[model samples]
Target chain A: MPAVTVRDLTRRFGPFLAVDHVSFDVEQGEIFGFLGSNGAGKSTTIRMLCGLLKPSSGTATVGGIDVGRDPEGVKRRIGYMSQRFSLYELLTVEENITFFGGLYGLDDRTLAERRAFALDMAGLKGRERTLTRDLAGGWRQRLALGCAILHEPRILFLDEPTGGVDPVSRRQFWLLINRLSESGVTVFVTTHYLDEAEHCHRLALMHSGRIAALGTVSELKNVFAKRAVVEVRTASPMEAVRALDDLPSVEKTSLFGTALHVWLRPGQRATEPLRERLDGLGIHAESLEFVQPSLEDVFMDVVERAGGTAA
Target chain B: MRRLLFLIRKEFQELRRNPRMFPVIFVAPVVQLAILGYAATTDVKNVPIVVVDADRSPVSRDLIGKFEGSPYFSVVDVTSNDGDVQREIESRRAWMALTIPPGYGDAIRNRRPVTVQIVADGSDSNSAGVGLAYASSLIAEKAAEIALQRRPPGAPTIGSIEARIRVWFNPQLLSQHFMVPGVLALLLMVITTVLGAMSVVREKELGTLEQLNVTPLKRWELTVGKLLPFGVIGIIDVLLVVAVAVLWFEIPLRGSFPLLFGLSLVYLLCTLGLGLFVSTISQSQQQAMMTAVFFFMFPMIYLSGFIFPIENMPAPIRPFTYLIPLRYYLVIVRGIFLKGVGLEAFWKDALLMLGWGVGVLMLATFRSKKTLG
Candidate 1:
């Protein structure tokens, strides 16, 4: 049985369909990334799954407990860290962890032990007595995550968990998430960072409240069937783009900065022929490079396939 | 239940950390009580006066002397004419005038009654009342003195009709005796609502309410968790006010301490629940405070029988006052403190307060659940 199952879940705020008939299931210990633009039902879906919101219609079960029927029971079985740091700013780090632990109804001894464990996991153990507000933004995010996981629930939901953190902190946060996932806790996360999406074992890309695509990293790259894009650096890139537009091998050409990105057919790589053509115009190849599709490319390809609503 | 205990501990720690709130919560009430205690009083004396003795006679001079001798009136001015006295009153420089007609001392020798007229500015009715008390007493004393001195041997005198008044509860009838209880009632309303509303609003602002919303702690548990600590602070405020009333103002407390405490707890529910209710509706802390002030302050004071008797309010307004919880609370507090009344006199008020407290808390708790919906 799946650790989390959502079927035909629909949410609406008045006429706007926030999560329109989206459904997915999370396997235990899977790192499931939910990718969407801001306001694209990512946090809303997380909130519903976490039992923080009542669904407008449809049903979800987390750890075999119906979320809508007994939300508090569902809450007990799941851990959630929202994008905004929810730990009390005025309280010390130890106080926030101990407080959240006690809130989950943990016994005193267990709460103490778990507090120490979480603080160590978040790398916030020694700063236990420091006020959360006094910490930097990255530390506060770690503290919030620490508080959420203190109870060791079977499943965890992180909503854009590393939103404004620096790249280094973001990498560190994801590393911690991977360690937790290894311990057999199902991790469901949402983020705008396509790079972060690359780290997930599987991901669901949503747009305007509907799932645009759902697949593993390799599957998404496979489905991103756009041809190899060659960057031709030239002084007049738009002129180069226009010159390359009518090439027999070229599918589409657009200028990016001072380089012309030429999407050629699958059989037509950025081969000697394309380079010879660009050299024919006064635009030298300078340094030509063929690019592999990134998760960002997959995201953009899927978003474009779904009508580019994210832009 | 355990979650609620942790929340309360967290709340206390937060309160201690924010040093700014210390002066506002602890020191403000004590200082206000002392200052308001001095400014407010039921005892009235020294009403401003500009007396014009038009008739420059010995009898008139003697009457003016009698007026000045009275403690209730301070002779701020001896004006030249009635016109001058009117100008003084209109300018708000004086609040009273004593006028004596042209009379000779022989009018009293012949046993002919002479009348002296005392006029007062009625713009300030309390001052007017005090002024009236002084003038009437002066007349009564002089009339009795004359009646006794020139009485035919064995005739009845005017002194036989004297009446001695005994003011119970507050024997001195100090306004603080009345204002202090009302201040406490208002204080509870202000602090409890602010604390309750602020707790929830801060969670919403900091995005923490959503964090706790999924926790094992239930809605009702969260409700009490947010409110109980502030309720404790409110009770502490009540104790402070009681000390100020009983010790500083010398207001008599005739009822049991347990009764006061029990009533305070009941009233706290209404106030604390009101704060929570506002917090649920408000999107921010500023909105919560504005809502509390706009909706709660005046009605809590006016309808609570604090400034004016609730019964004496207009017939249309009387029924609406029952909805104001402070009205019932004031009755319980005043009845306990002043009248020394037991459950026999105060059970209905106590029950009304309890009902309001429970009703508001339940409504607020349900509203919190609906936010998710």
Candidate 2:
């Protein structure tokens, strides 16, 4: 059975449709990534699945329990953590673990066992007495994850959990998430980081309260398969893009750092023509070559097609 | 039940670690009670008076002697000039002035009624009114005494009726006796209501409330867990302030201690409910504190008959006092402390307070939902 299944789940706030008829399914022990920018209905959908919000229409089931009808039953089977870490800053690491465990109604013996496990898992075994506020961002994030999973829940939902963390800590946090998934705990996470989305087995790119694309990384990259994306390195990328925009074969152009990626119409090749055109415009092009599209290209393309500004 | 215990334990742990909370909870009540206990009295004493003895006759001097002898009045200056009375009063030196007109002694000896003029500063109207009443009563007593003495001994005394006034509950009429219990009620309402609101809203500010909403904890469990600690603190404050009232102020707790404590518990339900209600409407601790103080606490104190008598309030506003839970609590607390009355005397007020408590609690609970929406 799937760990989570959402069908036409919609949430409305007054006249605003925050999550509009969204649907998806996550298999057991899979890392499902929901990618979107700020206010793209990522957090709203997570909240509904976690039983923290009621769906305005449709249904969602977490661990086989309907969220709208039996939110508490769904709550019992899932662990949730957010970007804030939500640990009491005044409390010690051990106390937070014990407190969350008690909240899940863990017995004394089980609480002691899980307490040691959480301490070891978060690398906080030796710093059990340290206040949560004193810990660095990485440690606090891990401690929060440890607290959330103290009940050994079958499903875990992380809402922008790596926000405001250093790159190194984010990588370390993802490592812990990988370990949990290896242990057969389904992980559902939302993030705007394209690089982090690479870690997920499957990803849904949300745009304006709707899923713009849902597939594996390679499958999503297939949008540029028939078309040609040529990367051109030039000193003046802005001038190069403007020079290539009027060409019949050129569909669109986007600046990629100092280089520019030019998209051509399907079954059309423009590498030689683009170089010749830039040379004609008195713009020096160092290199021009057809390259594979990255996830950032996919996100921009998806959002542009969905008629929303890309973040 | 166990989850509730954990939540309560977390709340207390947070409170202990908070540096400002310790002083606000444990020390502020004692300090406020001590300061307000001595400063909030309405008992007027030692009204300074400038006596103008224009009539240098023996009878006039004897009346001036009566003013000087009374404990209520201290003659700041005795002069023959009647104009000194206005100057002394305008300069704020004397609260009242007693002027004796010329030929005041002959009028009295002739058995004719003579009027003595008294000018009082009405800026401080409460003390001025009390001082005027005291002066007139003293003069009437002196007149009666002189009338009895001048008559021949056993010469058919005329029948007269007199009132022997006796003040019940407080014989000395000490304002502290009434004010101390009122302060106790006010302190409990301020502390518990503000603390309750701030505690919940603090969690909201820290984002922990959202975190808790995702947990399997029931809504009522969360409510009871969050507010039960403050209720405990409220009871402790009642005990502490009651001890101060009894030991330091010497205000009698003539009623049963358990009964007082029990009624205070019911009153706490109202205050804590108010706090919860504030949390539901506020998004931050600062907003919660503001709402609890300006919106809830101020209105309760003003309308509860704590400082101003509800009876003296405008007729239309007096009916609103019935809605203030503190109004019922003040009656219960003062009845216990001064009148030594039991449930038999204040059953109606107690029942009303309970009704308000439960109604407010239900309203607050209904508004406090586990779902974010």
Candidate that would win on lDDT? 2
Residue pairs in clash, model 1:
B42-B175
Give per-residue lDDT, candidate 1, residue B87: 85
Instruction: List residue ranges in candidate 1 displaced over 4 A.
Output: A235-248, A253-260, A270-285, B104-106, B156-166
The residue-by-residue lDDT of candidate 1 on B1-373, one tens digit each, is: 6778898899899999988878777888888778777776667777777877766777667767787887777888876477887788899888888776655356766789877677888888877887788788887887777778887888875557687778878776667777777777777787777778787888889888887787877789888887787888888888998898889887788888898988899999998998899888899999988888887766677777878887789999999888999998888878887888988997988898899999999999988862378
Give the runs in model 2 whose Cα sits over 4 Å from its true position.
Answer: none
Model 2 per-residue lDDT tens digits across residues A1-311:
89999999999999998999999999999999999999999999999999889999999999999999999898888999998999999999998998999999999999999999999988998899999999999999999999999999989999999999999999999999999999999999999999999999999999989999999888999988998899999899999889999998999999987789999999997578887898888999998999999999999999989998976
User: Could you give me the TM-score of model 2 versus the true structure?
Assistant: 0.98
Q: lDDT of model 2 at residue A59?
A: 94
Per-model TM against the reference: 0.94, 0.98
In candidate 2, how many Å is residue B367 off?
1.5
* Displacement of the residue A209 alpha carbon in candidate 1, Å: 1.0
lDDT of each: 0.82, 0.92
Q: Give one digit per residue, the lDDT tens place, for model 2 in B260-279.
A: 99999999999998898898
lDDT (Cα, tens digit) per residue for candidate 1, span A172-267:
888989998999989999999888999899999998898999989898888646578777776777677777788888877655546666777877
